[model samples]
Target: MAIEKIMGTETELGISAKDPRGFDPVSGSILLINAHRPIAEVKSIWDYTGENPLLDARGFEVSGERERPSQQDNRTINKLLRNGGRLYVDGAHPEYSTPECTNARDVVCYEKAGERIFELCLASANLSLPERQQIFIYKNNSDGKGNSYGHHENYLVDRRVPFDQIVQGLAPFLVTRLIFAGAGKVGVENGGERCDFQISQRADFFETFIGLDTMAKRPIINTRDEPHAD
Candidate 1:
């Protein structure tokens, strides 16, 4: 009898390197963040700062009274914004915890992944443009010692399509254990067989990795604009 060997294959989604889904850079609204594995490896930015200014800004910014977004838009962003998102981690970070993030103008906390690394959550008043781009470093060892990796990406999926279909197609891409868009920490695992090995370190899995990009400069629109009548 001949034995068939099943060798493991290494996938190159290149998530840790950069955003794979690719945004329009102008109209892409959905963005993927790895909140679990911030470049600095800091814990809970919301608690660390003791205030959430971005959240408070909603009343004054965007629209008065925090104009509730369309059900679809709200639902999509809610997943990414879950747990407060005050920490500024990756959504597809592979970690389960979301860092209890929050965004408010009055209660703002400018903190970073590393101790005194630098505040990175609110570079913009509208919760746009992260403050610290250095979080990709991953390690506080800045002197040749600077750990590698510090980037987050966002995808703008077309709302017309069903979320489940997207998940199914995307699953194959993630099966190899990629970071959604170039943000991985643990390269290799030391437990069980490779087949059973699952990616670890996701902060807000659904929200960060896969959510609406309404705030995107232009947004990655996947809807059909054939001028359909209601």
Candidate 2:
């Protein structure tokens, strides 16, 4: 049986606002998120009622409590674009989540379009900044420091397939496939170890085999059971 191929992606671009005093990424992210607000054709709040970060994919609840997205997030920083995509501030970074795409080509088009949208936003946002202050955005995942951003992808799987089977079949590919799929990076070093380059920037950061947490102790298999079906 063939499964319908539905896909989408979310990218968090690294941003820096530099001035004579210092640099602020939080302010830069906020500016980029709000850049389209003034000219937005339709403003729709993200409905968070269906969100359940605590529900595990393994069919049991997690121990820690789920924290609802704050009211400030809905009112201030989130926007549903006219192109059907979503732009919002996630943590200290501005994230662009592409609308549902049916095939690989459309997915690529939408992802590239996201970068153009950010470029336009940055151009608009910079006009309001001081002459000496400027904002720069990078599509890369890491900040060269210990912190890292993400390029998250979503897919729709047939409900007929057992979840455990799905995980078992996909684990090896997800763990080792980075050899060909990784975004190339500069050299890296930890303690006395050093390497010229790495396959995936986020690979070395995984601390556990399964969990719902994304920032700390990131799991190879994300257990969060948020429904992707619409």
Candidate 3:
């Protein structure tokens, strides 16, 4: 069956930007929203490293309140896959260990707690001007105890601007914003401490979501009284 052929789905709805609603149908940029209720955490039973569950490493439960995301990234990706959808990996979300992404063109890491993450590509052959999809999955490294992670979002600016300038310009704007996917830690940096973040940065997004790539991958920490929005 043609993927374009509409399939009746209660959980699915398509919209043309030119419709009566103010949604813009521009080909260059489009936002595909997953309206489904996202899980608060990823529960798992397998222990990847057979290490003692009581190991006190740098990422060992930062706080008793559970400092990291509890949900495993694979589960979220698997769910999207079952729904016939995928995500983008790029430099924005890279593998753990050598977290820094040399490809300036790809998305990158700024901050991370587990120092590990998973990457995926939902869009076909990079982002085209017309329509494309990109999904990024961040999995908190787990040796068993309580863990955490976030499904951060990245917008590929296809405009013809210098990557360095873009990185500098986008940072300030991003530091002040949050994503609708959900709330999580944010920062700016090329690869903060390796796979421990989205974009290595000098500051963190405090309590707000969305980290600016001001310093390439580092994110500033934001703290304010503004009513939070998810």
Candidate 3 local Cα displacement, residue 16, angstroms:
40
Instruction: Quickly count the clashes in candidate 1.
Output: 60
lDDT of 2 by residue, 36-118 (tens): 74454664688788777888887888767655667776756787887878888888788899999899899889989888889
Residue range 1-230, candidate 3, lDDT tens digits: 22221111111111222232443422211122212233342233222233232322222322222122234633322223222223222222222222223242322322221122121121321242233232322243211122222233333333344545655676666555534322333433322253444432223314323332222332332111111111
Give the candidate order by descending TM-score: 2, 3, 1
True-structure RMSD, every candidate: 20.2, 2.4, 19.9
Which portions of model 3 miss their true places by more than 4 Å? 1-84, 87-148, 178-230
Output the number of the TM-score-best candidate: 2
- Candidate 1 residue lDDT tens string, 1-230: 33222111111111122242442311212232322223444332222222222231112312123233455543333233222333222222211112322232212232232212212321122144333321222221011221212222223335465655766676566545454543333322223233322233331122233323322221122221221112
Instruction: Mark the regions of model 1 whose C-alpha exceeds 4 Å error after superposition.
Output: 1-152, 177-230
Please list all clashing residue pairs in model 2, or write none if there are none. Answer: none
lDDT of candidates 1 onward, in order: 0.28, 0.80, 0.28
